[model samples]
Target: MARSQKQKSVTPTPPSQLDRFDEANSARLGLICVQERIPEDYTRWDIEFLVDDRPSRLTCISPGEYGGVPHGLDGDFATILNVMYLEQGAPESGIVHTTAYQMLQRAGFPDSGQYYQSLQESLDRLKAATYTASESWRDHKRQRWTTVKFNIIERITAETQDGLGFGSGTTLKIQLARPVVESIREKYLKPLDMSFVLSLKRSLTRSLYRVLDAHRYQPSMTAEAAAEFRINLQQWARECKLRETVPARIKRNLESAHKELVERGYLTSVEYEGSRADTVIIYTFGDLPATTPAPEPVIEVVPDAPVTDALRRYGVAPTVARNLVSEFGESLVTQRLEKFEAMLKSGYQARKKSALLVDIIRDQGGKYADPEGYQVEPQRSEANLQAATVAKRMEAEEAQLNHRLQEEFRLLDHSEQAARALTQVRMFVGREVSERTLKTLLSAMTSEQVEPYEVYRAVTRAASELRLADFAHELRYAYGD
Candidate 1:
């Protein structure tokens, strides 16, 4: 017998070693609005941001779409910067081969269809919106500050499928605007602790972190120089495109984010000086912890054997079958079979049985649940059937909890909903399983012989676990004990 050689496993770059970057102009000017959502007719014009005690102006124009300017979830623009930096090196004109799924994964978003759709929407907004920097855009090569107009992303093309041009698996060709490319090529860039940024639980906090970091750090700065950052309350609010005007309201709005950053050790303290309209908010930077906190270990959920034994006959991938079992458990077969038999009795037919079965398993909205007329006998023995009753009761309780959460989520305003969703995405990214799976997929994506289907499987499995984890957190928060 001959021994076979084993391929070496690729190690991913640790979060601290990733060395991501942000464009200085965007950071200093706070070009993307921090609010999660804004009115479709919203607009910001000639907002003044101070640099070196000098007033620099910025104007954001959407010319199309909502919020009148780039706002909220548009923070994906920062992820765009990191991706471009990794692929293009010194940013020149070219198309980089990647997928929307990869982008979502890199940004700590769930690799699910809904998030993929959101990513596409954000990309369109970036391409359509224009920014005018007045004595604000930095021309490092010319060593001058100049006025410039540009889009964050120039163009995007994706391979089409089923009349849907952009999707998770679709290949993407994104071109960075020439001005953005020139800015980077000229070295007008700032190093960002991306892991720290993504670790933040709120978009407002992340935005504040970027803006403060820009003002605190200088190319020649020592530790003493970069220790503190201060800004006028009103000016800072305007720079962030805050929807509020009153100083008190602004402080109140920022309080939660301030508390979060402080607790996370990114800031030692956030202080305010003066009163009324003349207040100034001060930020004291804190030393980061020496190491990343290890994620809580994931307790693996083994799929029920009977569920897999039944699903495998439908030609489902083993991993997907496992996921379905983990999600639907003992009821996976009986419920769908009952519904399928009902559909047949009604003279309706599925073109393909396997396709219909898979669809039925995936649909959580009860699309194939017998329409209130049928029930199937349990396929298991009497003893096993009785044992499954507990699982069924737990499932029912989960459904009720989900309903309650959905109502709670619906009561929130648009901004709150967006903020909550963003936090969930970040939380998913911080999970050990998500991190491990992402590293493996990222390594494979860069290889010469990549397997697309395998990547999809990995993404699906990770996403399933992310959904479950997110639900568990929501449950604990909503109902203690």
Candidate 2:
């Protein structure tokens, strides 16, 4: 008798899920150069834009580095780095622990000496570069546009290096700048389709896709996606730091990218309107695979589940309730819901109560964090309890100090406020940062319309940048212990 044979089943490997970036960084002007083969001697790049009907500037400066500012391949390295950082859970320390080999692998680069050398050069460029954004950086958490200066990679510490200073075994601790770190922590991010992005053949196309994605899909829009985008040709050139401002030149440069994107189903078409400087470029979206990965299969919450019942009682849709419980877990959903209920009981009237409750859960904002029913540790030592109490007291004191400082600043006339902020900036951050801060303040104030909040925020932020401990000490001394 012949024996029966069975075939083994094999599951296909899924495409890599590696893409995300702070929307601000992706959209910032002149942060990443679109040009390939930038001269090593190039040191600065600047771009101007109209933000809220006001002129804004972004400047990139790199000094004392042979690589000058980041351009071309550096942008690819940056995307890979950001993806790795998010993949590691966006630790509060702002440090992403990774290896050069791992980064190359994620970027789909081969493990070879040539690629390793290229990675090292990119790291050097990133470390040396600094960006100054004048009223162009969007702080989504604060819901404002503000001035900021930061490096893409603040510092890098490698555990082991070969003769070339970076190797496959070299473990890296890459620290992001405070602004970038804060944006990630606050979830001011947008999805990137790394599979599609990396598949693009041209660096310019990849750069265009990243910048355009920011314009196409924003965090604030209620619509799930944006289908069209329009921009002036000259302004687009300047935004991308392209040397070509003439319409024909710009279009010629973009022609290949346009064709590539259209062929890849990322854009339906790229069309032009008018001519010369008045030319406008229009981009129509296509059915590219979603930038975000598909959600995991939903596990429906049982009718008897406490979280589901609680959500239902609040008039949440069944599908929404199940997703909330499945995505954030029942424990956190319950916690946030309880917090929302407490707010309602305290006379906090919400126009859309269900929506507000969902926001409270998803945002994890401070408004709903200090409510009753917070999770507490099961056991605590006497010393640990004392330490926790001290920490809470310190936090309260810091909050009070911040409120007092802002209040005092608000009380001053505009001129007085500017003078005070400049003094503090110079005292804490030295002459360079102070001069830049003053320049931004003067520029903004001299404009026909000025935003006091933006000016004050910039100065205060600069003061806390380089010498925060000293700044705090001075503030405490002036205001009293």
Candidate 3:
């Protein structure tokens, strides 16, 4: 049996056709192969399959020129098979054809026939499939994260031997939850502490940017985070008993810094709030000026100084002196004072004349009317009646002229007619037309003109209608030449 035993024919298993295809395709196309479980929030389109122990995932998509499907028909089929294998990584002992068909469908090729298409068509279809699926998955993830919520909790406690209020304590204990503390320490506290301090130095170096910027120097980067920083710093300071007085060295440094800030225009002044010997220096960036110039003094001329002085001193009403001065100038005030004492002694009506004079000044037209010549009672009555008559007559004339000119101009189209109508309007209003008035008249003239004489006639008619014959004559004399 040993002599007759021939060499057993050993058959080597063939390399996976799909694997070979994927390698060719990878070489043909420069696509990266990745393997990761599609996130739950992602759509099915974004899901990709990978071969075990391989960096390349068999994407149902084409790759770069040298990485994916090769240049020919066999190469294209190899690429399709690679995609299928990626779709289903498990090998089938005999179910290879059925598995291939299923993968082809998933990769957007309906059947085996469609899977073995021309290289360009297959690549185009695969690219479209991959892009569409990836986009859908990305959108799904975005929507999912939009609804995600992160929760945080912070527990702050204060322990005081003196039993001060909530915020006031000698010893403070703060316990933050793990997640919240991690987040705060990672995203806010550490970065803010380092960055904010750096930012402060840079800003100071830049001269605080502006006076207002320096005034608003409280950290606005992260308000809550900055508040936490300040609270912690204060607590540390209190524990170290750094309040009431900073270390002498620190104080000297701060003083020097403040002086430099003032010189650089970053700060305006330094103030001390504590006792004279041990003062707390406070720096102000911008403060309003301390003193403003007083307004210039008014120089008032007072006539009859002695009398005016006495009147002012004795509390005599200023209205009386003002009235006397207004009525008889400076001399009247002196004369009034001379007679004032006599009038007061004789009881000869000291205030009666002053009252009459004040009343006369208050009445319209009384200032021009001679008080001694015009009898106040009759003159006021006659003037009222005359004014009423003149106003009524003028109103009637204005109404008549406006009505006549409106009727006449409504029937005319000449520029001169329009000018005349405007002139009539002016006359009705009782204003004299001048060189400026004539220019305005010409502006009102329309561009259309059949004849210049027609314009003259229209102006003449309008002047006659408005009873502004004098204005018409002036216009003729000016323009006729």
Candidate 4:
């Protein structure tokens, strides 16, 4: 009677130590196409996503080299996705140029080494990202379904000259992966609200926003499979990828995230009850704008609409569809709905479903293929002179484009250059240099018609005068040498 097996003792991490998505408003919902797993729960990391639901999973490809995924927060990659959309106006061909300062400003990241370093991680993650989807959407060329894989960014040109991060480089560009570019070209991508996504402050809270954004009207907060826990605490913890097992602390974080959502007007009400073994979390997606919401979305309690089901299957009630429509154009949302219908017709079903989905946009729908670090060499015939000739022509085109952009940067006026120079100064030391002083120096540079290098020197001088010595590293980039 006294024989008891040895129980494994588990150490819990604190909330402060938990990893979260700290990147500003970057959760892109394009990978929203996986199905809920069957009744049996696999890993917490593996949410029960239903095929009808169109749940997406983002597999990180070693984030430490780029400085790790936003240092434990979610949404950094999403932010990169959004920024790319803003820069390229949706995955266009070839390379698209955008300053790190511009990207950082848009993503709500301060112009600092730490955040820039984090952005680097995000860049690395995107360059190496592999997205998988459960439901298939129709591409312009072909109708696609599950088991497709692709990278987000093909390559990134960021020069950390003098270690000034991605901003100081004379050139900065992000190349969207071919498959992703095609998705954008074919109108399969979902549009996320830059302001709303950026407004979310926490990883978990933002997760809810994403899930809710995918759903419409009142989405189901019910368990994915009939046999799965409706909302088990332990399962929920795993879905959130929380290493912290301390019950009291977990409760605090949960409550805090929930409260933040309600206060921010994303959810009308959230209730968690029942025992840990058998629990349920009810979510009521509140109307952000009660006046003119899209026709009351029919709550099918099924994955009827890929974009809507992507969030609703996980109990997300998206309240931002209209805002997204007003911004990203209506065609994108319509495409998501079309994908949902196609999946339903194919009798497609995702055996696995995750409980959490961002409620930021039900209009955005996407697909993911289970592909690893996307790189496939094109087959070349022996002595392929044609390929070589084409490559040279493309290279020539790129050089011409780069030259044009550089010329534009070089000839910018005082106001524009001053603004850009000020951004650069702040990039090194969190904007420690006074704007007025930097402006005065930049005005002199413009007035004297100084070279770009001279402008750099003036900024350096102004920084030193202002007692901001940390910009010593940024000084090296003055000449673009």
Q: Which one wins on TM-score? A: 2
lDDT at 456, model 1: 35
Residues 1-481 of candidate 1 have per-residue lDDT tens digits of 0111121122222223434556566676777777666776776555866544567778777864533677655675555644445333442343444566557655656656777776777778877778888777777766767888888877887764435745544557787766666655555656566656655656666666666666765432222225577778988888777878899999987787789777777678999999988899998767533233222211111223555656666666655666676666656555565576577677777787667777886787867546556655655424365366656865765565445445555664543444334333333333323434433434443452443333333333456666556543543343223
Model 1 compared with the native: what TM-score?
Answer: 0.55
* Tens digits of lDDT, candidate 4, 1-481: 0111121122222212222111111122223211111112221122333333665343322234443322233244444554455333342343565566656655555557666665665566566544443243334335534344555667887655455555533245677665555444444433344445556565455554554444321222111111111345654444454444454455665676678667765566776687544555666554333333222111111112234334344443333433344454334443333444344355556443221112222423434321343322333212342456656765765565445435545665555555565455544443334445554545555666555444544545555477456353343334222
Question: Tens-digit lDDT track for model 3 on 12-81?
Answer: 1111110111211122122222111112222112122222222222223333432332112222222333
lDDT of each: 0.59, 0.65, 0.31, 0.43
> Using Cα atoms with residue i matched to residue i, what is each candidate's TM-score against the true structure?
0.55, 0.57, 0.15, 0.47
**All candidates in order of TM-score, best leading:** 2, 1, 4, 3
When 2 and 4 are scored with TM-score, the better candidate is: 2
Full candidate order by lDDT, most accurate first? 2, 1, 4, 3
Q: Number of backbone collisions per candidate, in order?
A: 0, 0, 18, 57
- For residue 448, what is the lDDT in candidate 3? 44
Regions of model 1 farther than 4 Å from truth: 1-18, 50-55, 64-67, 218-225, 288-481
The sequence of per-residue lDDT tens digits that candidate 2 reaches over residues 11-31 is 111112323343345544446
Q: How far is 441's C-alpha from truth in model 3 (Å)?
A: 41
The total number of steric clashes, by the backbone 3 Å criterion, in model 4 comes to 57
